[model samples]
Target: MEKKIRFVNGEQVQTIGVFAGSETLRGYRRDVATITTTGIDYAQAVALFTDGAKWSIVEVGEEQKEKVYDWSSHGVAGPITDNRDGTLIIKMGKNNTVEQDLQDKVDTARQETAQAQAVTEALAGQGVATVEAAQAMRMMIENAAALLPDSEAAAVPSLSKSWVVGEAVKPGDRRYYAPTGRLYKVREGQGHTTQADWTPDKTPAMWVVIDIAHAGTQDDPIPAAKGMEYEYGKYYSDPDDGKTYLCKRIGEADGGKIVLHYLPHDLIGQYFEEA
Candidate 1:
């Protein structure tokens, strides 16, 4: 209710009447500096600042008096009283959570960096593999991919035959990315079975690949067919369980491990996998 200098961060003030100057108030961003020698009592000081139009200033009350505090950085910090004391009584929390937080952050970073380094070293050693090993891996992939009928009928390992499972894809069955972005079919039983095994409609229930890109919302099923589109054999949500039908019309997502439709809503369930 009365006038007083507000606490703020800035250089000390020396002028007296200047505190009341209209221009002075505009120039000041925060608290006005009052010399300890003002000799005005708390009530008197409050009245002065109030009259000067300093609505922001408030008189320091008994409750606001400084008190002795034990700080982590400095032992016993300050005592309650009014005076020109430069010292600040920092009350340190019994448990120095700040220190613990900093330590935890440092430890986490160190662990992560160490793990990365270890992985890098291990992989660095495997930079080069034998031609035989490469050939063996090629054979295995060929076998797996062979299960899927290749549309191009491309030779093995030459980007002719792709991979798929019975043409229809299921949720979580598997996703693959070939060197070439061609559509390959995997064998049936590798993907999900549609909820409705009804006869083929006008479309013959051909599978098209679709990516939901996310998991369905809390109340809704996942969405599918978010990103790129492609042709596939069968569309399914889960071939193993045969619980749901993502979509019969395949986008570009099926065959490898992508879905045609994200079950409940494609937008809601889009990309829920990577995250």
Candidate 2:
């Protein structure tokens, strides 16, 4: 359930839509038109009804839309209604968790800036002044770029190529082996020599599955079950293993056949059971 706070006090708007029988806080009716509230403050309008908190008003007629209205405007609003779906609704109000989340984001941004500043200051002390040098220093510090000098270590071979012994493998690093059309993710820090040591099915503890079970080129997309029209944005289950695949994008393949962009592991089955 997601309850959104559409409007708040002190919000600036270009224009407001008003309909027939619109009431003022002083109990006077006004005609319908697209009125501007640029000069008028939000806290000065009268509410038409006092049944509950006036939070929003519905713009009726051909196009039904929700607009923000404060107590200062003679707009209609009622108590918060239950709109439960799958996601838990986080309405921003007094002492809500959403405020805490926002604060956490701010704190994270500050910490990241501080880390980057520390790296920049260290590089500056080393007489490195160029923007590219500063960015390269930050990347090295963050372990995003390999720090091993060219002479010290040979080029890190791609996963599609032969395995290089003693290569530093980090957690969550993914690689695809073209020979077997298999993909593997690093689970722990380990060195690999032979190709079999990195095979996904053989080394379960050392690697994680990160690619689609079926792989092919865009021109020759993988085929689904016969007569199965893959609908866009729909989830389909593999009868063999019960794994779910989501159809994201549809594109034409050879001979004008439609191919779906496959996204794995949506796991929407827990929410409802198929009859």
How good is model 1 by TM-score? Answer: 0.23
Residue-level lDDT of model 2, residues 1-275, one tens digit each, is 11122233423322243222322222323321223222233332222123232234324333444443433332323222122331121111211133445777999999998786776687557756567987676556435313433212222312122223445566645454444444445655643443545454456556544333333233323333322234444344544455555444335222232322222332234221221
Q: What lDDT does each candidate get?
A: 0.33, 0.38
lDDT (Cα) of model 1: 0.33
Model 1: weakest 10-residue lDDT segment is 14-23
User: What is the per-residue lDDT of model 1 for residues 152-228, given as tens digits with 9 covering 90 to 100?
Assistant: 22233342233333444543222233533323233243344433442111111333332343233323333223232
Off by more than 4 A, model 2: 1-54, 57-112, 115-133, 138-275
The candidate scoring highest on TM-score is 1
Clashing pairs in 2: 1-87, 1-89, 25-46, 45-72
Question: Which candidate tops lDDT?
Answer: 2
Q: How does each model score on TM-score?
A: 0.23, 0.22
Candidate 2: lDDT of 95? 19
lDDT of 2: 0.38
